[model samples]
Target: MKKLLLFLLTCLLAIHLAFPQPPAIRYQVAEPRLADSLDISHYAKKRGLRAGAMVFGLNMGVWTFDRFILKGDYAYINMHTIKENIKHGFVWDNDAFETNMFMHPYHGNLYYNSARSNGYNYWQSGLFALGGSLMWEVFMENEHPSANDVIATPIGGMALGEVTYRVSDLILDDRKGGWSRFGLEFAAFVVSPMRGLTRIINGDAWKRRSTSGKQFGVPNVSVDISMGIRTLELKDEILDQGMGIATEIKVAYGDRFDTEETKPYDYFSINANLNFQASQPVLGQLNIIGRLSARNLVDKPKHYLSLGLYQHFDYYDSDTISVSSAKTPYKFCTPASFGGGFIYQYKGLKNWDINAFAHLNAILLGGSLSDYYKVDKRIYNLASGYSTKMGADFIFKKEVFAISARYDVYHMFTWKGYSGEIDWRKIEPKTLNAQGDRSRAILHAVGLRADIRLRNRLYLTGTFMNYTRNTKYRYFSDVFSNSSEGRLMLTYKF
Candidate 1:
């Protein structure tokens, strides 16, 4: 996990250093290539085979490291163990929250990109992730397969994978040559290695040609990178803990108001944050909202409204903080979620803009901190439920000032748990006795932000957010907790 975070930080820093200023904007429209087309029948079997090989290679490499260097017992697998695992079926494995929630999804991203970069589209690449996860669970590891992993890997992989793929596309340009092209390719490789590898194999890394245009149709994108200091307070206290150096990268891909055509991820927004503090993970939060489809209801000179189906991926993890009499460990995520919503934009006097959205999402599978149940190092519960989210932005449109506010509410229910009388210590690791801490948790969050443009592409931003969790347990008293954070940042937009 530390290594993964470090790699991510290094990549982001390299991008920042490479492009001190935004590149010249170019608009290109070209006919879609057969490889990039939506038709699923035009699959490349060779690329698919290569993707499969890569998945097998990754599984073997990890197993080798774990078996030899780490000497981990779980890495030791045999035909008999594989047979046992197949017979045992799916169970909720007790692994660290970060390992299951963060690392597995990342691994799945690699699997997804293996196919995505190899002439496969969004929907087709997802199959590689699913296949890769199944290979690892049934053939690579000795432990029984996990229910949460199968869901998280492919679904979360699609979200993160597509984001990286688009970001890489935004970086690569075959028209440029020499150091300029080399630098761009290197940065894109850092973001998506599988794509880089495929490019190398196909001799496109250094081969400069007249611009054939982007594989995915060119979409206008806006990027903001921010650096700042943030302080997290437990309950309602101020400055109770040390501050952390916070950095964030926000990307808005494609124009949401463009109602001419709608695709799976044509309009998506991503928010990724990193915190350098003692008590927090290097990755603080990663949120993705991608529009799957849309229909224009009202289109006018002053007002535009559209209804759309969206895909949501949210992940938040923090260390346990004592708040009053409660132990609040801020760990909640919805790796697989689908929702429908409406997007309304009002262009008032002097080009002023007001944007608002409301969404109701069904959480297929999610994780939240548990009150009592603990197995191995796992203290989070796996559950299914729903959420309601709404947000609005008041942009002065003068590029000078903007204010935004958002509210989110989640309701989750855990269906698999053991009684308090059961001897958890004697439960077999391979058995599906206790899935997680059985409880119902409701999480509510409110956030506000203000941004002032300090320069042409620079802004000073201030943000505050408060989170509250209420967990009701079957065998224990209810737990209620609160946490809040405030941040001041300097943001550069591209």
Candidate 2:
């Protein structure tokens, strides 16, 4: 049954890529001006050819690495595996979720950069991404190609790629020279290596003008650096407590409520978070939300509905301390997800704004370590889930002060994996039982934030978050855990 659903999804995605919707009439008001200034027809064809060549070159490079460096049989090109994959069609893979869901999309974003840097629009760039992923799957490896990878790669790649492209633009200053130009270009490369390489190859790395042209709206970027203490408890017993330094950077592009023909990612948000601590100093996450389409409600100028896609990458590793035995069990999880959802926003009320969103996503692949009873067990699970978030903010004194609160809940169903046993020594010797049982889990998070304007483009911020997770298995004691964190930080925006 699951296989059938996966195959259907693959077919749908292929069709969507092969025959995209007609390009919307974007920037029509400026078309005449652009046409007079530049040769649009000739440039468009040249860009397309360059983008295709880049994609082909990238695929060949990956194939070389897999065949020569990895030397794994699965990485070799085998006609037998290719034939089998074609006959059997799409199937769920045995690889961990992180690799399929997270890493594949990361590679696909590089493919996306090839098209984006050559002047393709967002939708067209996504199609190129899809084409690149398909070529790699069909020709790059000996193992059977996966349906999940095809679905996750292009969609998730476009989401992550757009954000990378925008952030790289912020880091680059083509008008500078000497060390400043070199430094800026290097930093942009760090954010988006593929785009930077393309720039260098095209002799635009030190051009005196921006290549992408002006964006639709003013872009806002902010950074928050904070040091704080966090406390975690399980079953009413203190597990671990520590002080940590965390940093978050946010980029918001355009306004969602703008009354104009919206382009893909016309209104987007990207956030990156990093935490430094003893147990897991490299705890990292990248979240991206891009608007696909939106429309204003009839007779309500301030109310709008939007459809968007999101890509989330999370890596968490920590130590758990047992209160009684003092034994420490290590826990780690690397889960990545790609999904789409609907967003509703209201700004009709004076000095008040409300926003709500709901999304359903598939956990295409993931890996985790479970320690339900202090016995560390490695596990892998694939699941489906939904999440909802709602928030409201009050503005006062003309943007000088603001208070906001948000609540979020996520639920996931793990039907194929096992939950950790309370006592591993007492479990029966059945094969199914040894693998673990199915489970369901819910995560609840609530946060409140207040910002006081200290000066223009600067603010003092205080934020608090309470998070809880509850897991229930068909045959095990339900486990509940919670944590609280608070921070005071100074934020600067540009």
Candidate 3:
């Protein structure tokens, strides 16, 4: 229940960003005579109606699929079950997997589009996502509704939805014609299908408009493609090494200090990475952060403090030899967390930028597969932790070369007293020999990154990261592991 309240409060903050303000144009003007210059009130009613229709259509589609193709009893949702579930209150459900991590966010994306295409702001669109999630929980399924779904769907959805929306916006070209315009529009559609649907519905898909005079501020975007080698070493074990390929994309929205009206997610950064090792996918990570508040501390704003909310996702799955057996077993771990943090930035030194941040996060939920005593199996843990990071970036020779270094520490704790134990086989009462056993882990990482500009919009980049983890169990021996990776890549900036 506490978790539910925390999520609810966070969502409220999101909605606050969407509260109605005095009639003013919020979008940056790219051109003086653009169609968007028309009075917002002129189409307010029509947009509202369209939004409603979209909500209804989405619900209908989900219901039809659930009842017909899936042959589920969602159409006959049990009101009694829902009531009972509500009475029981919220919980950290362990049965959820792909639905919580992927599908719920996708649904939220659809809801966001329903609101955004109708001219709602980013934060306002999140409210629509929440409404849609509530509807599904209350009336769309026969089984009792899940608390996890309600939280993950809206928040995670909004994060991913906004990113998709922005990327689509970057791809769209309204001024072009012929195959070039069609390709651009098609690419945008691939990024945001709901937006495409709404455009077709409104006849905007077939219309051509001059966008040459538009002057919107463009965000900074970069993509990195690297080939790397990674090695993992367990205490006293031989190094396990493999060649890997990694791709990373980062986008930094316009500077926050440049404007007074700091809209939600106006100063945001997004990063996504995928890595494959030895012909198999091994790791993936996604990070999104949006500044919520900021204040200048120096005369020329050389020093500042900012607060932000962040979402983090990490997944690693690999095959390794089990300590207790000769068989190679699969090891996997996935952690997704959301929280807010504070950042301090200093630019007092010429050509240098220094940043430090501390974050407190709720694990929300996570899972792992661990092997004990030759038994290759899966185990799970729920933990909350905090992290601290500090980094410095140095620019040299008129920004022709840049060097950066960072260090981070993370700590997590989990206590299980039989009540939270899912599979007792791995964590037997006798093995623990006591109640209220606690487990803790800490990870330390250091990274170095460098970029060499080869041209105005292209660069050569290199990065190296070293990571170490230490775990302690109340009644078991401590486990220690470490890994290192190095990458060389080409980066393009836009």
Candidate 4:
């Protein structure tokens, strides 16, 4: 649930940037007063305070957006890796292999083990993430964080926040707090629902209680399912013709060891995809494609599958520890989803003129990676994600004339923790015991490309991106605010 909330929140952040109404273009009247003394200590202290305040303010703003906009979002995405993808060198390979990830955040296996602990709730911590995210927006104003964005964000988030808090209180007292406040505020930025009205969905207090929401994975069962259709191939005519169908599913469950030392959130997942296509289509110029997927659904969600699993570590620390302090990944487990759709298109413009698809995916993957452990997995559908921008695509030049963008603001719906007990490693080899676990990090990508003729069948492309980040037990869900760069590739064929 936390993961779903985070993903939806991130999507909202992007939407907030491009709201329907243009913001009042306000120019900075004057620079805010900075510590002039330049005394190193005073300067540092001043900066720290400013940072904290900005963080708080920004968080407040985003949360407000949730209340006003999306109302609340329910995340539905697959976060798992198939053994075949790994064997085929398609998995996200960092430093570790054959590891029990998600144990740290999902089950608290790496951090607390057995000592039951407790701390801040979702609202309090959300305040922290929002504060920081907003601060960055401010800094980006006129400069890196943007002051205009900060102001607008707060206005939007606050209006939504007030309504959400009052509503939560009016109907259910137990569900009111920083988490729901944060959830409602953030949800708005993603979906407007209506001009002024708000949509309230997924108020799962009962589910929260049943799952014991936190960072540790203790939920008894987790059922994740995804089924849809699309076209990998296309026909020259209509979009529904000569297409394909596809589906994928996964599930997991575990308990026993409340923390890493004694036991861990033990579980497994099954993922499968099926596709079928026709040989030819309209004008005998295209082909048909189809896909199907099936996954077993369980009645409950595992601790790792619930919202509280990832933040479980916060319960044991003074403030909060890093997701990997204990060396557990706490990701890589998922439920099942199997379904597929179709599409059709034509060719021969520039590189090829075409039209195609249905029920596509706008998939995004994430987690963490560091020197201590790697987490790039458990990123619901951690593999290369391809979203439904399943429309007609027309390439004007060679493949190099690639122009692709997705504007799905109107359609579709979207999409941890630990224990402390004992270290089974002491008595047996690692794999045999589920007592303690960890997940580990980074990729560098740079690509530059040039188009070549069919005979050469060569292209030049370059892309550069690599980053390492640590998610604290209480870190904000919208942390794409912290990003770095790294890698490169180019090719020429003749």
- lDDT tens digits, residues 1-494, model 1? 64564444333322221111111111223323322342223223347777777777877888899899999988889999899989988888878888888788888888898888777777888999899899888887888888889989988888888888877877787778899999999999999887787778778788776662256546777678889876666233323453678888777777777766686787788888788876678987888898888999999998999989988888888874433324544788898888998888888768567888889999998888887767777888888899988877777766587777788888998988877677766866456445576789999877777667787777776667777899998877899978666667788876
lDDT of 4 at 249: 23
Candidate order, TM-score descending: 1, 3, 2, 4
Using TM-score as the yardstick, the better of models 1 and 4 is 1
lDDT of 2 by residue, 346-390 (tens): 678886565555655544433333334222232433345655555
Local accuracy of candidate 4 as per-residue lDDT tens digits, 1-494? 64564344333222111101101111121232222232212212222333344344434554456545755331111122223222332112221211222211211110110111112222332343345434333322111232222222232222223222222222222223567745643453232221112112223332223211223222333232322332221112222332333332222223211222211112212222233333311111000111212122222222111111110100000011132222221222111111132333344343554433343332122222222221332221122123222233334544434322222111111112223343324432211211112222112111121122232333222111112233322212322212211111122221
RMSD of every prediction: 7.4, 11.7, 11.2, 26.5
The best candidate by TM-score is 1
lDDT score at residue 472, model 2, on the 0-100 scale: 80
Model 4 CA lDDT for position 304: 18
Cα lDDT listed for each candidate: 0.75, 0.56, 0.54, 0.24
TM-score of 3: 0.71
Candidate 1, poorest ten consecutive residues by summed lDDT: 17-26
Candidate 3 CA-lDDT value = 0.54
Sort order, lDDT high to low: 1, 2, 3, 4
After superposition, which runs of candidate 3 have C-alpha atoms over 4 Å from their true positions?
A: 1-49, 52-56, 59-91, 95-99, 141-143, 210-217, 220-241, 256-261, 278-283, 299-379, 413-417, 420-441, 454-457, 470-481
Off by over 4 Å in 4: 1-95, 98-394, 397-416, 419-455, 464-494
For all predicted structures, in order, the TM-scores are 0.87, 0.70, 0.71, 0.22
Alpha carbon lDDT at 173, candidate 3? 57
